[model samples]
Target: MKFAAFSGVFIAHSIQEAMKLTQKLGMDGIEIAAREPHLSPTTSAPRIKGIKALAADLGLEIPVLAGYMGGFSTASDQECEQAFDDFNRLLDMGGELGSSMIRVAPGGPNAFLAHDYHYAKAAHWLNKCAEAAQEYQIKLVLEIHNQSLVETVDSSLKLLHLIEHDHVGMIHDAGNMYITETDYGRDSIVNLGKHLFHVHVKDEIRVAEVGAPGTFLNLTHRGEEGFLQSRLGEGAADHQPMFDALKEVGYNGWITLECHAPYPAYERLAHDFQIVKKMLSWEHA
Candidate 1:
């Protein structure tokens, strides 16, 4: 399986630095975050070209561009059009960067309480985005993240069914799934089946208890009380079963590390890379 590092972790550094560090860490690719200090909707054409050339020069793949656009689940007609317009820009940027896929969010921050109609709205726009992405020969992978309508496997599958587009798929974000109390192992991978287009690995552990008020604290999800980021294998997340499930399903796609531990950037990435290498037995290879 191909391995990649999410550039969001390197937001403090320049895109060039992030790429170089990713190569040094023994990752095959770097998933660029389509945001500031790296890229954005207003990024100049010349800059995009420069970034692409540098990636090629460094011999690193731009597997996917993690986008920050969402709100399909709760937007007015005009707002929806604007969001789609922005997505079109992202697709253009992804094509220019030689990325095979673009990450899309299912809904806005409060999508956990989204109604059935809200899900339909997100699905409809995703279908449109999928059609547009096909022209660029790129796929749109929805993120199964907390606070989103597709946080659970069942919900994600339902949205995919609604979308019904060949180029549309989903990313199994195990960390976020853990926050939402979704199955993040064999059952989830098997149930997603052909719809699983990508994977994100990270670890989090509960740090506080929920009281009667039940107010969700920062970094906590609806299903969980409070949590903090932890290194791979050092956290409560059991990645072995998840990796075994991926192998069992023959999923040879990109497994992007989204490490967010408290350690220094390079140390955290390098350490997590070693852990993943051992899990996948790539160290021997």
Candidate 2:
């Protein structure tokens, strides 16, 4: 396994700056955000190539395209067609940047409506997207996020099973599954162990008075209500066990550090990278 960081946390800076920061933090690779203020394949080809060249010059690899943002759940026919066009464009960009995987989300208001509806939409589009990805030798890893249709482990696994394609996989994010009421954390890795193509390490804390529903907070806020980002080893997530589980299952993909740690983004990201490296028993590769 290798270490990488998401560029979105550092979106306030330029893509080059973000990449340089990741390299300076002693990370092995980077997951570039494919959105505005970053490198969107739709509008920036020359810039994308330049960024790819810069990473290669620094002896760093672009393991995944982290910002292929678009949703197709409620999109009209034209919107859906545009989504496919965008998907193909990103696959081309992934090839140009030497990345074999692209991260996407299940977009649509319906995602929040019902499980069966969301899962069906996701399966249909993912399969169609996977067909395009297969042509470019790129895998589309659907990220398990809090707002999307496949927010939980079981849902994500079911979606993957429905897609039923080798070019489609899952991204297990610790923070997204951090809830006080359930043990979805352990089940996430265990159930989708085989289809995990990428990993996002984040932590959250749930705080509430006894007998009350605890408010989830990320490590960054520490004291805020609801979930907030946190530094590694300081939040509710026990990442060491998760790392061990990944190792047990022989997961060799890139483990990208998503530094949602608030305040002093650079320093916090550096610290998070080091913590994850130690937990994964990672050395400079």
Candidate 3:
């Protein structure tokens, strides 16, 4: 599997700076966060072209664009349309950026309020987006996140089944899955099978200790839990089993380092890269 650093972790840095830092950290690519202070819907073609050229020059791949577009579960049709419109723009940008995939949220009213109808609505809109994404030769991947309808593996598979498009798939966000206390590791990855389009690796721990520096609380459908983001392998979420499962599944897609631990972005990314390199048995030049 190839490795990448999520640019969302480098929000404080310029796009160029993020890209450079990613390359310097010995990553194979950079997953550009397609939002503010980075590349947004309003970002021009010239800027997109320049970003692509720079990535190429730096020997980096632009594997995926992490977009902030999603309202597929909202109560209004107009809101869904607007979200789709923004997603369409992101697809156009992805085409110019030469990215193969883009990350999408399933929908949110949180997991508790989201019902089967919300899931169906999200699938309908996602299928529509899949059609649009085909034009740009990009794959739309739904992130398995807690605040959304696709929080668990079963729910995510249900949405994928409803969408029924080969161009759409799932991002196995291990950290979020851990936070939600959902099924993960070999079982989840094997279940995802071909639908596991991409992966995000971060580490998290329960706030049993109470006084951790970066401790925060997350209230989800599964109830409330105090959590802290930690460096990979140093946290409660062990990724070795997940990596083994990816190998078993022959998943050669991008694995993005999306650590949100409170630390300097460069240092965090660099430290995480070493761990990932070891995990994947990847060697540098």
Best by lDDT: 3
**In candidate 2, what are the lDDT values of residues 1-285, reduced to their tens digit?**
887888887899998898898889888888888887887756577887788789988888998987555576655667767777887888888898889899876663323344576667767877888888887888888887755666667666667777868777888877766642234445567888668788888776654533333234322212334654678777787777778788888887888888676657688777887777687675751
- Model 3: how far is 54 from its true place, Å? 1.0
lDDT of 2 at 191: 80
lDDT of 3 by residue, 75-125 (tens): 478877888888898888888778999887767766656678888888888
Q: What is the C-alpha RMSD of each candidate to the true structure, in Å?
A: 3.3, 4.8, 2.0
Q: Which residue pairs collide in model 3, if any?
A: none
lDDT of every predicted structure (CA atoms): 0.83, 0.73, 0.85
Candidate that scores best on TM-score: 3
Residue 230 lDDT in candidate 1: 79
Cα lDDT, model 2, residue 197: 81
Q: How far is 34's C-alpha from truth in model 1 (Å)?
A: 0.9
lDDT (10s digit) by residue, model 1, range 29-81:
99988899988777899999998898898888999999877678887878778
